[model samples]
Target: MSSVRRAVSAPAARLGLVRALVGGYTLVYLARRRKMLRKVVRTDPAMFAPVGPVRALRRPVPAPVADALNDATLVSTALFTLGAGHRLIGPLHSALLSWTLSYRNSWSMIFHTDNALVVHTLVLGASRAADAVSADALLARGPQPAAHPRYHWPLRLMNASTTAVYLLSGVSKVARADGWSWATGDSLRRQVAIDGVRKEVFGSHAAPTAYALYRHKALFTLFAVGSLILELGAPLSLLGRRFGRLWAVSWFGMHWGIRAIMGIKFRYQMSGVAFAAWFDVERLLELARRTR
Candidate 1:
């Protein structure tokens, strides 16, 4: 028990930093999408197909109820970010936010980018993230413990969940397409060309890089193989911090390459938030300070 506790003991400050970044980003995201969220209630009932736990609600959610829930979600997200009454408020925040996300996906194309952020938020909610540098921590009268499993486990779990997404995505691609054919240049060339056609159909310009890369089968094949390697090796992130860092850099680079070639962006995955556990928050802060 002692060894386990020691193993998971994380600096309270690190946990606090992760909480603030994750929460703040989430709050910003929700705020930016507030208009779209409101439209959810106003959307036609014919378009609704409940997802996740929202399916348990049976019938379509009344607009007024949906409006109220959306409001509550925004408010709770704010509270969660501030780490105010986190223990009690966190679960409420998670539940409401989950509902809103499920509702959104039910009505249109599912945006997988936010999935990582949501998973991280839920893990934070379930942990004692407010033990430091938060409203709850500030309110406490006595000195707090320097380290605890409550903090580390959540980060670990979040890390695992994020990595699982990559692994599953890679596995799905392999399962659906089968063999190395999917990783060949011809496949990439076909995909890029198809995407280009898709963009033209929608009256949008395809990624400029896509056109340039389409004619180069050999180079595109290399890219396809690299992508496969990155995705398939995602589980190596669970090995340790070193492996996690390696995976983060490789994954981040992979996304950048994808954007350059396919003109696609997985913002959340590429933003370093999904791989937050691989690097030390304090070290990043220190480096930022040094640059100034």
Candidate 2:
């Protein structure tokens, strides 16, 4: 519990409080999922769309990114439930993911966004593990296919691609809102009052204290400017040099602040896994002993 709090800072406590609310939603959602399956089996008339189209069945085999992400989260959840790597990320591993997000399916070729994030994180871990084993005389085995999805390369590419999505999200908000009217406190207050979206997902309006301040025009402008900085400067976190540390830490603070202030948790906040390009844990472990 302490580790969760320390790792995530003060927001962890709020997360703890809000978690059951989220869980309750998930529970109801699962109930609905079961209800849907029952309807599908029973051939319910309501299943038909107004235009006379029937929804498709579930996909067989991996849908590339979606299945891969499912697999990754499954393993992560198992490990977390067993208490290993539990501190690094909390129940985030088990959080219900929106695998059917339209944007992921809008494109025909590239993997879905959820899958992209998880697969990239896994590939990052795989490469580090391989680097660590390479220096071993006996433990280092031949090609690890599980670690290498392409089935050949012992070391995978570490792309650290989440920053792009982060920036894109900021950009998306601006584009959708017809420029950064979010710069104004009034806009933010109205957005916060949105019923189903916030109530169903986050349970409440950030922290009560922060919400009050969110009504201030000056503070809203400050937040808007800070968000712009975060979005524009996101790429800095990908740098491998000392500057990356500064950039990543700054983003970390910003993310936690957002969570604490708006009850909005960025799914990719501690996505250090996505920053594989910047750092490699397995390599660090291998190098820590001064081995080749």
Candidate 3:
């Protein structure tokens, strides 16, 4: 093959391999880890909060909410992954998922990007290269005039919304700060103190260290410095494709780590959608060509 051919084909090939692995993992994860997923989804108090109902709002559903949430989540996630209710189901569940995450959840520390990941994946997953990637693609460039099987409207909505949100987040930090470097331990500590549930959840995790880091001038200041750098650069992601993708890589690792080490599932159902924020969907096509 010519050099040009190779250049065009590599990404799709890589994408395919990733998809297969992701699919296999999803299969295994569903078959073997369903119980575990159920456990975490229910037991983790921080994962959900009892909000006022459409009418009056009830206390924790008599039966543990996790099992209930799992059943519903399974229904939505299944429809999304199977390409069942592409539009109607995915966005509805996405909204519900976003609403459930509260300031208390560890995942909420990052401006609730998890919601975007989940909704985008549920809808666009069919097109994903990873099992977490799902079979519902949100941004197919082909099959126009009919239903574009490549991408879903919900995913596009998410991409646009995420870009807007990231932009807003960057603007807020920059607007208030002494020019970035504002995230330090003090800020984190203050944030936790204000949010009752966060204080309860994470304060328990690192306990003495949480306080020590909160008080130690050097450590707090150092973390604070790193925090703003990330937040400030976040909006630049809106500038173009490359920036968004690089951000996706970091965000993906960050959330995945939260799940593995912290025992918290941060957007488990939508991790693959992060790729859409940065890379062109066409890249998948190129990878597909190479593998072929």
Report the Cα RMSD per candidate: 2.4, 12.9, 8.8
Clashes of each: 1, 1, 27
Cα-lDDT of candidate 2: 0.42
TM-score per candidate = 0.91, 0.48, 0.48
- Arranged by TM-score with the best first, the candidates are 1, 2, 3
Task: Write candidate 3's Cα lDDT for 51-159 as tens digits.
Answer: 3231123323323564565456555544544444444654654444433332113222443544444444444344432222334333443331322323233333445
Please list the residue runs of candidate 2 whose C-alpha ends up more than 4 Å from where it truly belongs after superposition. 1-116, 125-129, 133-138, 141-160, 184-186, 195-206, 236-240, 271-277, 280-292
lDDT of 1: 0.79
Of the candidates shown, which would achieve the greatest TM-score relative to the real structure? Answer: 1
How big is the positional error of residue 109 in model 1, measured in Å on the Cα after superposition? 1.4
Superposed model 1: Cα runs more than 4 Å off? 1-6, 284-292
Model 3: which ten-residue window has the lowest total lDDT?
Answer: 143-152
Kindly list the per-residue Cα lDDT of model 1 for residues 1-292, writing each as its tens digit: 9987887778776777787778777777778988888887688878777777778866677787888888888899888888899989888888888888887787777777778888888888887888876888888856866787777888889888888888887787678755667887676688789988998899988888887767778898788788778778877777888888887888888888788767788876667666776677856666778999
Where model 3 places Cα greater than 4 Å from the true spot, the runs are 1-49, 52-56, 60-69, 85-88, 91-114, 118-156, 163-223, 250-272
Model 2 lDDT, residue 225, Cα: 73
On TM-score, who's better, 1 or 2?
A: 1
Give the per-residue lDDT of model 2 (tens digit) for 1-292.
Answer: 7654333222211222122222233333334444333333334333323210112423322345444544454454343323333334233444323332221233233333344344443332332222212222124344432222221121113234556666776777678645766655455556655632466576543466564664476776777777777776677655444666666666767767766666665544443333333333344544667964
lDDT of 2 at 281: 39
